[model samples]
Target: MSLSVSAVPPLLPAASYEYRTVRPVHHGHMGEPRTDVLAAEEPLEISLVYGPEEARRRRTLAVTMRTPGDDAALAAGFLLTEGIIQHKAELRAVVPCPDVTKAEERGNVIRAELVPGIVFDEARLERHFYTSSSCGVCGKTSIEAVQAASCPVLPAPAPLLPAALVHELPQRLRAAQAVFDQTGGLHAAALFRPAGELLLTCEDVGRHNAVDKLVGHALLRDWLPLHALVLLVSGRASFELVQKAAVAGLPVLAAVGAPSSLAVQAAEQFGLTLLGFVRDNRFNIYTHPERITG
Candidate 1:
C-alpha cells in the first residue's frame, strides 16, 4: 500500500488574484477597474532521512529550498548530481517521509535509503551542505583538487549538428517552461542536438536542480556519452553544474549566462567544452572552441 503524502504540496507556481487598474475606459464604458490573478513562485524544502532502525531514528540530511513538485525526482537527481549515490542499485528507495500519520506536524521531509554496501559518512555528507549555484566547493581551491574526485574523461566525437536545428532551440525551450512563464523565478537546463535539435528540458526554482533533473533523465535512460548533443542552461555556469555534465559525459555545456571561474577550470580539466553568455547570435567559448564553426 502507498503511504499518504499530504506534505508534498504544489512544487511550481500557480496564479493568484489581485486588484489592478486598467487603461482609460471611462467608468461607464468598461465598468470598474479590473482585477486579475497571476501565478507566483512556490518554494519547497528537500530533506533526507536515514537510520539503522525502524523507529526513533530519522535524521535530516539536507534541505534544499526548491519548488515543491517533482519532490521524489528532485531527491533522486540531487543524489546523482552530488555524487552521493552512484547507480540505481545503490539506492533502495527514494520516498516521502514515512511518518504519514503526522506528516503535517513533522513537516515535509523525504527519505532516501542506501543499499547495504553503500554507507554515507559525515565528511561525504558535509559536501552536500556546501553546495550553492553561486559559489560552492570552496575547498577545491586548486585544479588538482577537482581531478581527484572526477569521473572518467569522455572522448570527443565530431558531431554533425546542423545550423537549422540550432535556431529552433529557444522556442522549444520556452514552450516547456510552464513554471518560468508564471513565476519567472527559476532557471532551466535543456539537452539538444549538436545540430541544435531539442531533446528535453527541465525547470526548477534552483538552477542546479533543473540541470540535475535534465542530466538525471539522461542517466536514467542510459544516454550518457552525450557527444552527439549539447547542454544549454538558462543561467550562469558553475562548477557543480559542470561536474554533473561531466559525470553524464556531456561534451559541451552552454549557458545563457556568465561562467564562473571554477566552472571554466572544471570543464577544461574534464575534457568538456564550456560556453557562456549564449544569447543573441553569439556566445563566449571558455574552452575547446573547435566544436563551433561557421
Candidate 2:
C-alpha cells in the first residue's frame, strides 16, 4: 500500500497558461497588437469512486475553476484537506476522467478512486459546495461544516527559522513560479525548510487550489505531518488557506498580504504561526512567534 511517487499513477498534464491576441492601449491611443500570456482558467470536475469492490459508486465531489496544470494534485489535496481521505494509501489511483464528450475538456475532469472498505455517509454530499478561482471553498452552511477535522493543536515551533530567512522566501517563491512570471496572473504556495531551502512549489489561478496542489504533491510523496516546514503564499492569508496548512501539519503560514480577522482567529485556535505582510524585507507574526528567531 506504500506507493512511491514513481509507482503512483500519474495525472495527465494540462496548460497552466495560454496565449491570446490583444490590443495594447497606452494613454488614450490604441497601441499595436500583441500576444498576451493569460493564465488559463478552466473548471476541473473532481469525482470520487468508493464502495465495496463488488459494488462501486461514483460521486461528484466538487468542480473548481483553476489554472489547468496539476489537476490531479488539486483533487488529491482537496480530498486530503477536506478530511475525505487521510493519506495516499487510501487512494487507488488518480487519473483524468475519459468519459467526456469534448476531447479537450477531458483534461479538465479528474477522478480519484479510493480503495475499497472506506466508510462514509453518502448524504454528506447533499451540502453542495461552490468553488471559485478567487475564494476557494464556499457554501459550507455552518462553522462545523467549514472546519477541517484533521488539524490538531500543533506543538511549539522548534528548531526555529531565522527572521532573515523568512524575509527572503517571497523572492525564492517568486523565482520558482514559472507560469506566474509569464502571465502575472497565478497564485502560488511553496514549502521551505528551516534552513530556507525551497522544497516544493505549485501555482494556480485559485490560491486555495495552489495550496491543495501542494498538499496533493506532498501527500502522494508521503509528506504528511509537514510539521517541520514553513508555508508561504503569494497573496493574503485566508481562513481557508490556514485550514489547509494546519491540516497538513505545517507549523507556519506566511502570506505576502494581510491576514483577515477570521484567518487570525483560526490560526490562534489551531495553534499555528500566522504571519502576514511578508514583503519588502519585513513580515508580521500574528500568533505563535516561538517558531521564528532573530
Candidate 3:
C-alpha cells in the first residue's frame, strides 16, 4: 500500500496565493466588491555556494518570478535541468539566504550550498542571463545550446499503458493542484507511476517553474532518473520542458495542451514519449507512440 504524506517538505515557503478585493462585472454592470484570490508572483533569487570549507564561494545563479512556495525544490530542479549538478548528493543544503540588505528580501532568496570539493562549471552559469515566469529559456543563447546538453539514452521499447489510463492523468493532476484551484492562474506539473498512481504535484505562475519544483522534490527524495513513470504538465509542452524531463530521465511526458515543434524534435532526439492534447478521451502521440497501447 502507498503511504500517505501529510507533513510538508523541507525548505518550502508559505502560502502560494493571496487574497484581494475586486469588483465583478455582471451583464456589463459593476457588481458588489468581493475578495478574490490570486496566485502570488514574486522574484526568487537562486544562489549557489561552493568551494572548500574554509573559503566558500557564492553567486546568484538565476532569478525567477514564481508563486511563493516550494522554492528549495525550484532551485534544485533548475540546477539539475540546467546540467549544473547531476544528483542530489551534490547538494549539501538548501536554505533561505539571510544576508540580504533588505529585510523584505530575506526569505525571497534561496541559497543552495554544494558539497565541498565538487567541480564547479563557471561557463554553464554564463549561458543563463535571466528567467521569467512565462518562459524558462528566456536567457538561453539558442535552442541548439539547450539540445546540445548531455542526456542519458532512454531504454528501448518504452512502457505501454491503456489509452484510458493516460486520459485520466489531466484530471488527476488537476485535482492535486490546490493552488491553481484557489487562484485559477497557476501552471502545474505532476508525476505518476507507470501504473497511473499519482506521486507528486506542484504549481507556479511560470510553467517552467512548476516543472522545476517537481524535479527538485524528486531530487530531494532520491527519485532522480524518473525512468519508469510519466510526467504531465498543465500547459503546452515546450522544448525546455522536454529537456528538463529528459534530464530527470522521465520516460513519458503528457500535456493537457499542445506541443511545440522544437518540443517534438527534442522528445524524438531524447527517446522520450511525448503526448499532447490529452483530454476528452483523445490525445496525440508526437513521439514514441509504441509506449501507449490501445
Q: Which is the leading candidate under lDDT?
A: 3
Across 161-246, the per-residue lDDT of candidate 2 in tens digits comes to: 89999899999999888777788998888888789878888888889999999989889888787888889999999878888898
Where is model 3 more than 4 Å wrong at Cα?
Answer: 1-14, 129-144
Model 2 spans with C-alpha error above 4 angstroms: 1-14, 128-148
- Candidate 3 global lDDT: 0.83
Report the candidate with higher lDDT, 1 versus 3: 3
Q: Mind sharing the TM-score for model 1? A: 0.75
Per-residue lDDT of 136 in model 3: 46
Ordered from best to worst lDDT, the candidate numbers read 3, 2, 1
**Model 2's TM-score against the true structure:** 0.89
Q: What's the true lDDT of residue 101 in model 3?
A: 92
After aligning candidate 2 to the native by TM-score, how far in Å is the CA of 77 from where it should be? 0.3
- Report the C-alpha lDDT of model 3 over 1-294, residue by residue, as the tens digit: 222443232322346778999999999999999999988899999999988999998989889998888888899999888877888998999998978899768779999999998895677777652242366453333345655555665777667867889989988888787777678998988888878888888889999999999999888887777777789999999887988899898889999999988788878877899999999988999998888888
**Pairs with steric clashes in candidate 3:** none
Candidate 1 global Cα RMSD: 6.9
**Cα deviation of 180 in candidate 2 (Å)?**
1.2
lDDT of every predicted structure (CA atoms):
0.64, 0.82, 0.83
TM-scores across all candidates? 0.75, 0.89, 0.90
